[model samples]
Target: MRNDVRALRLSGGLSQAELAGAMGVSRQTVNAIETGRYSPSLTLAVRLARYFERTVEEVFHVDCD
Candidate 1:
């Protein structure tokens, strides 16, 4: 899985901590997501998309091989 989390966060001028707070997760979790070390649950994904005013497809992408 890949996502535009880092770019979105940067564009919104939000730190990992800030985005984590907004998403109700730990900063490490946000970091992990942005770094592709972790994939969020569907609920979390939805929350993240909503927070960024985007759809889940806009934030996350499935890298089909």
Candidate 2:
């Protein structure tokens, strides 16, 4: 999976720690998501999208290989 989490966070003027606090996750979790080392669950994805006021597709994409 690929996501624009870092871009979105930066565009919103938020640091990873701030995003994690808003999403109820740890900073490392947000970092992992931004770096593509981890994929979020469906529930978490929805939460993130809701927080960013975007659709899930706008934030994440399937990387067809």
Candidate 3:
């Protein structure tokens, strides 16, 4: 999976730490998500969508191989 999290956060004027705090996660977790080093769980994904006020599809995308 690939996500537009960094772009979204930047556009929203949120730093990584701010986004992490809003999502109730660690900054490293957000970094991991942004870097594609980790894939968020469904719950986290939902939380992220809720925080950004966006649909999951708007925040994340399935990258076909």
* Stronger candidate by lDDT (1 vs 3): 1
Query: Which scores better on TM-score, 2 or 3?
Result: 2
lDDT of each: 0.95, 0.94, 0.92
All models, RMSD in angstroms: 0.8, 1.0, 1.1
TM-score of candidate 1 against the unseen true structure: 0.94
| lDDT of the structure predicted as candidate 2 | 0.94
Worst 10 residues of 2 by lDDT: 56-65
**Candidate order by decreasing TM-score:** 1, 2, 3
- The most accurate candidate by lDDT is 1
Candidate 2 local lDDT, 1-65, one digit each (tens):
89988999999999999999999999999999999999999999989988999999999998787
Clashing pairs in 3: none
**Per-prediction TM-score to the true structure, in the order listed:** 0.94, 0.94, 0.90
Clash count for candidate 1 is: 0
